[model samples]
Target chain A: MTFRAERRGTFRAERRGTFRAERRGAFRAEVRDQIAKWRRDGVFEPRSDSWLTGYDEDFSRRLGARGWIGLTWRGRGFADRFVLTEELLRAGAPVAAHWIADRQIGPAIARLGSAALKQALLPGIEAGDVRFCLGMSEPDAGSDLASVRTRAVRTDGGWLLDGQKVWSSHAHRATHAYVLARTSTGEHKHRGLTEFVLDMSAPGVTARQIPDMRGPGHFCEVFFDGAFVPDSAVLGSVGDGWGQVTGQLAFERGGPERVLSTYPLLALTLAAAGPADAGRVGELVARLTALRRLGKQVAARMDAGEAPIGAAATLKMLGNRFEVDVIEVARSVPGVPRAAIDDAVLAAPGFSLRGGTTEVLGVVIAREAMGAVG
Target chain B: MSMPDVEEAAVKVLGGAADMRDAARITAEQGWHLLGVPEPEGAGGTLADLTGVVRAVSAAGLSSPLPELHAPVVLSVRGQLIAPWGPAWENVNLAGEPYDIGDAPSSGAVLTRWRILHAARLVGGCQGAAARTAAYAATRVQFGRPIARFQAVSALVAEAHAQAVLAAAGLEAALADPEDDLVAVAALATASRAGTAVARVAHQVHGAIGVTQEMGLERLTRRLWAWRDLPGEAELEPLLGLLGEERAWDLGAGDE
Candidate 1:
């Protein structure tokens, strides 16, 4: 028998048990069905880089209505969520509307928020009724998060937030912003900082778009001048913001998203590739498969209630580098136009820059390793 | 026994097996090679079970004849490599090299299966080296602090660990369908790549000490370089030719 025929038989013969196999099959079907529907309606372009250009609130709601959002919070493990994400990313679906909120914000709130706050916000988040934007990075404090100058001062009713938050992704469109502010000064920079769920529609809050390298200004500069937030808006403990943000980074950095961001280009390259491109293409696929497995393992770790920052950092760094590698390899395949692969290649720089810069992640991993030893 | 049980048991039995002589004694006394054979003839164990044993023995830096001894029988019967045994040298191989046929001609199938096992074992070696190197880096002090405190060292160690994970995962996926030569080829290719990259980084991390014969890393690294081309490109040609051009990239679909 031919090698392909043998492999086809092997694939069919394998059974991964009832619960997992059925769940994975059903999830892939649901995603495929959604993709087909969107294609029919002219809503999603399978060819374009959906992550960069496809931020549809309606699409996010559509997925939410299908109960795809808040997967971890609903007792579906990270592995299950990973399956959902891999299919979405492979299809290049527009998932940016609820990506951050679904990936991290909801989990942070569920873990740290008050019972009343949970009652008020959790359902909306899960249903995609509300979207969230991160308010961590500032004009001067991109990777140096502890240096954020956004100050929250005490008031009779609550606290007043005064300062600017730059690179706040989609803040202009989001309903709420998870703002980290200095509550008080201390000997160390991390102490006395606080996290607040600021209402974007509040009287003193404003957001202006910051055009990135790509055309869309999906990134925004959020401004708050005495925006009054009630005490109930505190997402976690008053002075535990540093720990909270760090915890959220574990969720943000470790996922299929980090590794498979450029997968759409890979898929396109495969469709157009020739015999000559097989070796390089095969190499990329092997690395991607391995990283995907590691990503799932990390997801399982997160599901077990352990926030392994160093492991997550390692995955992000490796995955981000792989993303760039895929772009370079795809560009090399003969007869494929630079124009076809340009968007993904152009968006590639942010892969390493956004979550945490490669240099910063190296330090984080180093510190974690040293700490483990000591 | 189940795959996890096999893994745990092998870890227990081989954790201190250490060298080749020790491994041979344990294998002979325990009939461990029978675990790779099928029902009635020997103990019935899954391919995953056999893979677990390979991983443990490799990680412990011990050598086993189980793959060489059992794979020939399985491959020969299937008419894969050299045809089923002839009378001249039915059981014993006279060639100095472990892979070459003795006085009797054997199919390349035995060599192919042997290389697959070698790839899996190399992955095991990497798992061991990555752990040992990480520990060494974390404790070895330089400039009054652990060298792991430096990005240069930590990144190399982490990168090696990542490669090890990839190799293991790729192997496990290939073993999931042991019958597919295509999967085996891909798995072996990835293993070869990872083993080379990991050995370089490991040596770089350990500096002078890693190269010493006493460190025992050479036991695996030497075999890795030697066995990398056991089947080589010639043996892979039939499978690769059948895989064609575009279907090559789709090999990873099995992994998912």
Candidate 2:
């Protein structure tokens, strides 16, 4: 009887596995079909770094309507989300509107937010009715995020935030800002930090556009004179922001976005490639193949409930190089549009800078390597 | 035994060998070369089982002719078969490793096997070089501190390690589907590129002493250089070109 039950259980598990795989495949096909229809209808145009530069609320709403956002929180696995995100990135779809919230913040809020916070934000986040922009980097704190000077002092209902955040992408349009502030002095700079979710329309809050070399970009400088964030808006715990934010780095760094920023250009280059360009194209494809595998591994690890920070950093560091190299290869291909090449070239500089600079990523990765050796 | 067990066994057998000949004799004694060969005529195992031994041998910086031995016939890129016992010309590669040249029948199957093994060697070489470089950077102090504390040196260490990872990923993909010619081609191409990049960063981080035999960094770097261009990146380009955009994307997605 025991052996029979065990065999039956194994059969059921296998069936469940098959069912899950079929569902994932169907979901992927549906997304691809929708993207194709959108392309045909001129709903969106493919572009490089669309996750950052391309912000189309309608497109985001469409995805949200299809139940693609906050996938993990909705009981979907990271592998399913991996397929969705990879397809979206491959198409270079305008995913910026809900990118930040959907990618990391929504999950963070679900895991650590107050019940009141979840009631207020999770629904809108799922529906793409709300957008979140990061307020981690201050004028003085780029790589050294622990040294952020943004201060949040206790107030009547919550905390009063006052500080300046630079390079807050899409802050002007975002409905909310995920801010990190110094709450108190501690033994180390890494301590006394706290994370808060603040409403963008709060009193004494302002966002100014910062034009980059790529012309008017999504980059913005956000200032909080005395913006109020309710206690319920605090993410995780007070003075635990350092650990919480660092924990999200793997999610931020390990995604199809890091590797496929210039995939649209690569497709174009491949279409235009000649015999002379075969070697270059092959080299790029080989690297892409390897990177995609690494990205998949990262997703699987996340699914297994492991925060693969070092692997993610490694993927980003090498992936950033591949993203730039694709632009160069695109330049050499004959029929690729000059404008697309220009856009990719301009965007190439930021590939290694955002999230964590390549230098910082190197430090993380080197430490991980040394740790392995020891 | 499992793959890791096979690998551990190979390491134990090959770890303290004096030279290439000694390693080869011990590996033969252990029947490593016959690992994947079906039984009755030879010991029974699978291609996956041979991976660990191949990786272990190459990672140890010994040129034991294991890859060539595993194949039914060894052929050069020019379609010349490698003679088992002797060479037409006495030659050594850039790493001072033996380069066989002779006249025999060439086989595509043998060439593919050799390419996969060589790619695995390159991946192992990159890992070995990167690990040694990281260890050196962490210990070699400059200006009152370890150079690893410097972002410049750390970047080199990271690059080396990342390339090793990328190469390993490629090798894993190829091994997952060895029959797929495009996957094999891409794996070799990726490993070749990574081998060179890792060697470059490994040397840059190691400095002048790295080139010296005493430092021993050259052992892996030299093999990387020798193995990387054995078939060369250019040779695999045409095969990769055969992968159309959709097929190429599918190759990367690795969706079964």
Task: Output the number of the lDDT-best candidate.
Answer: 2
Q: Which 10 consecutive positions of candidate 1 chain A have the poorest summed lDDT?
A: A1-10
DockQ category of candidate 2? acceptable
Q: Per-residue lDDT tens digits of candidate 2, residues A204-299?
A: 899999999967789999999999999999999999999999999999999889999999999888888888888889889888888988887898
TM-score, candidate 1, is: 0.84
Q: What is candidate 2's local distance difference test score?
A: 0.83
- lDDT per model vs. reference: 0.71, 0.83
Tens-place lDDT per residue, model 2, B1-256, is 4446556667766767775567666766666776556664545555655666787767766566667667745455545555432333266777776556766665776766767777888888988888998999999999999999998999899888998999888877776566666777788899998899999999999899999999888889998998887777877865675366788887733333
Per prediction, the TM-score for chain B is 0.74, 0.87
Q: Give the fraction of reference interface contacts each candidate recovers.
A: 0.12, 0.45
Q: Which residue runs does candidate 1 get wrong by more than 4 Å?
A: A1-19, A47-49, A363-374, B1-29, B36-40, B73-97, B101-116, B175-182, B227-256
- The TM-score values for the models, in the order shown, are 0.84, 0.91
